[model samples]
Each structure stands twice: as structure tokens, then as C-alpha cells.
Target: MLHSSHEPTDYQCPFCELLNDQPFSPDNLCAPSDLIYRTPLVAAIMACDGFGNYGGHVMIIPTAHLEALYDLDEQTGSAIMWETKRVALAMKLAWNPAGTSTRQHNEPAGNQHVWHYHQHVFPRYADDELYRQLRHRVSVEDRARKALELRSALFSAEHPYRLTDTDVVR
Candidate 1:
């Protein structure tokens, strides 16, 4: 068990509730690809509530149930960041976003609605309202397709990029 004072005794953490269940609700889970990216200590999946920006938006979460960043383990933290960067990179490559944004909220005062610690990675567009953008509710099938696309983008980006004075190629 995660040795954290913030662990909820009243109700289960929604992320922990995922427990790799059948992703029927696209907003709560991914149908086809549950976790697009997974390391030993963490997992990255398309958040069901990515209404703010692009299709490839995702959340990087620790596999264990930790309430806040302070409660997160070093190894889990590293794994989360690694997956976050990969997802952001893949979003850039696949979606051609104007930019990328990463957000993490802590505690009620900090607007952290969920108790589980996670990082949000979204593809920023020129007109995106950032925190003010209205989140679009998407379907499970659509999200699954997007997840597949992100995986492909990450796979394609896996190769090294070498630059020449005249040209750039892998």
C-alpha cells in the first residue's frame, strides 16, 4: 500500500478504480487501447476528459495509488515524466500542434479534483483557450483510434534523427 496520509478511506480513487477494467465509457477509459504507454512503474492513457485541445491528449499516471506529487515515489515519478515526454512528443509529431501544455493540480485549493496524482499533456493550438477551453466528450471508438495513431507516431519517432548541414533525416 502507498504510505501516504492523503490516501482516501471514504471513497476509492477513480484512477485506481480503473484497475485496467473494460473501457466502456470513453471519458473514463480507453476501449481498444487501455494504456497507450506503460513502463514498469507508470502508465499513460488518453484521458476521457480531454476536451481542451487535440485528439492525442493524455494523462500520465502512476500504477500505484498515490494522492499527490509529494506522495509519489522517485521511480514512479521518473517513469511518469518519461512517458509524459514521449506522449507530448508523439502528439507534436502526429497532430502538428502549435505547442504543448503540461498541467498537474494538487489538493482542493489547487483545484485537484481527483486524489490520484497524474500529469496532463495536451496538444496546444493557436486558438486553444488553455484552462478555459471547453472539453469535448468523445466516444470510445474514436479515442481508441486516436490511441492507435499515437502509438504509431511514437513508434515512427523511435528512430534517431540525424541532421546534415544540407538536409535532415533519420
Candidate 2:
């Protein structure tokens, strides 16, 4: 097992709670409907916070409770990268943004709020200034709607987003 650098002793991981299909916290805005793609090893959900004009960004997380990248296994990491690409492509089909970018934080100094390992996928537009913008909370309703839109693109026949049992991490 890998040691965690920043997880608190009494941490209640919001991502784990969300995966369990329960309210992660009072401030949690994620719901089952926000889940766009899920496999036994990885899942992608719509974020409840958006930066600047980009609402409904995607967060790809490992199903297990690995605290950070230092603790992630190769199998789970591969699954995440696969899902990340699929979600990014789906965002293009769903929103047609200028481009998309991915971000991840590890320790508190790195600005990681959640203890669980996760990667953020943002839809970037011209002059979006994503790094400079403050993240604002997104409504559950809007997140669910965006999840549906992205899910449609993710599962469309033109795209090979579906993961079969063979795709599972061994």
C-alpha cells in the first residue's frame, strides 16, 4: 500500500460517498444522474462546480478510495486515462467547445480538496481564462441535464465508449 501525503485522519471522501449513491455531504451537489460513464474500476461524473463560463465539467475518479496519484495503481490509472479520453471526445460532440483540458491536484499545497484520486476535464473556449476564474457551485438539475447530454455523445454508435467486461482492469 502507498502512503498518503494529505488525507486527514477523519476524512470523509465525497467521491466515495457519491459512488455509493448517497449524499456525499450537505454541500454535495452530485447525484446518480450526474454519472455519465461508470465501470467497476472507474467512473466519470459531472462536477458541481464550474470555472468561468464552463459549467458541468467532468471529473473522472477511481472507484476505489485511493487518496492521490502516489497511491493509484497502474490498472486503475489506465482505466482513468481511457475514460478521460472518452469523456473529452464526448464533450466535443456534446458541446463543441474550442478545446478541452485536463487537470489534477495531489496535495493540499496542490489545491486538492478531495482526498480521493480524481482528474478534472474542462471544456475550454477562446479566452476562457479557466485558471484565473473562481469555481462556482452548479445546480444539481443543470448538472443532470449536462450529464445526459454528454452521455448521449459518449454512448453514440459513432464513438466506441462502451467498456465490456474484458476492458475491466485485471
Candidate 3:
């Protein structure tokens, strides 16, 4: 089924470019090292921008470039949700924040910046002001450090999700 796309005719999807290893553009802040979890169907990467006091938030996206929620398939959506849960669990183990939250935007009116369908997982604290605060670009070093933290917590012996061949990126 052909779905209507909101992107411009010459639009270049940053997520697709990043996933495909296409020519690097400074506009895309995501890096290979920022990937904390990935499978054949989906990937969870550290967002370059962080909200409020938190840094190293994660976004789970489908491996295939589906433009929006309306364009997503069941299998891919399930994969994204699975990764989102794992990332939330990892965040709890890693940071021990008060709680965690997941957010997804659909179109321009919904504040969806990227055309690709993705879900964000954030660690929330009492006064984090996640919605009120502006997003700022986190340092590359900080992102890498947080990625390591999440990766360690995600694959650690204490976590329920073990590193199986099916779940882990090889």
C-alpha cells in the first residue's frame, strides 16, 4: 500500500541516511557508537539532544524507513515497542531515575521533527521539567559515555533481557 508522505519531494531522511551508512551530514547527530540496542528489525540510539536535566535519551526506530506511525507495519511497530521497553529497563538500572517515559510524535502539528517513525525513551525525575525545558545538544563525549552506561546496564547479568543471538546486534 502506498501511503501519503508529508516530506518534500527532495527530502532526505536523516534516519534512513544514518541507517544506510550513506554520506554523513552534520545535521544528523546520531553516530554508530550511540546505538545501545539493535536487532534485525529495530534500533535504539542515543539522541544528541537531551531534555531538561537529563542527557543521553534513547530513540527506538524501525530498521525500515517508515515515514510515520500511519505507515508503520505491525512487525516493525512491535520491534520498536520491544526495544523501547528494554531501553526503559536499562535506563532504570543505569540511572535509577524516579521513573521513565516514552513519547512519540506523528506529524508537524504533533511536533514530529524527523519524518521517520521513532519512539523516545526518557528518564524522568521529580523536577526534570521534561516538557517545559528546551532541548540542547549534548556533547559527543557525554553521549558516548551514556551509551556505554546503557549498553552495560542493558547487557549486564542483573537485567532480565539477556544477550541472545536474536536480540543482540551481531
Residue 25's lDDT within candidate 1 is 40
lDDT of 2 by residue, 97-169 (tens): 9999999998888888888888999989996778886779888899999999987887677666754446443
TM-score winner? 3
lDDT of each: 0.69, 0.83, 0.83
| Model 1 stretches astray by more than 4 angstroms | 1-10, 20-34, 52-56, 157-170
Q: CA lDDT of 142 in candidate 1? A: 68
Q: What is the lDDT of candidate 3?
A: 0.83
TM-score list, all predictions: 0.77, 0.89, 0.92
RMSD, one per candidate, in order: 6.9, 2.9, 1.9
Candidate 2 regions with alpha-carbon error over 4 angstroms: 1-3, 160-170
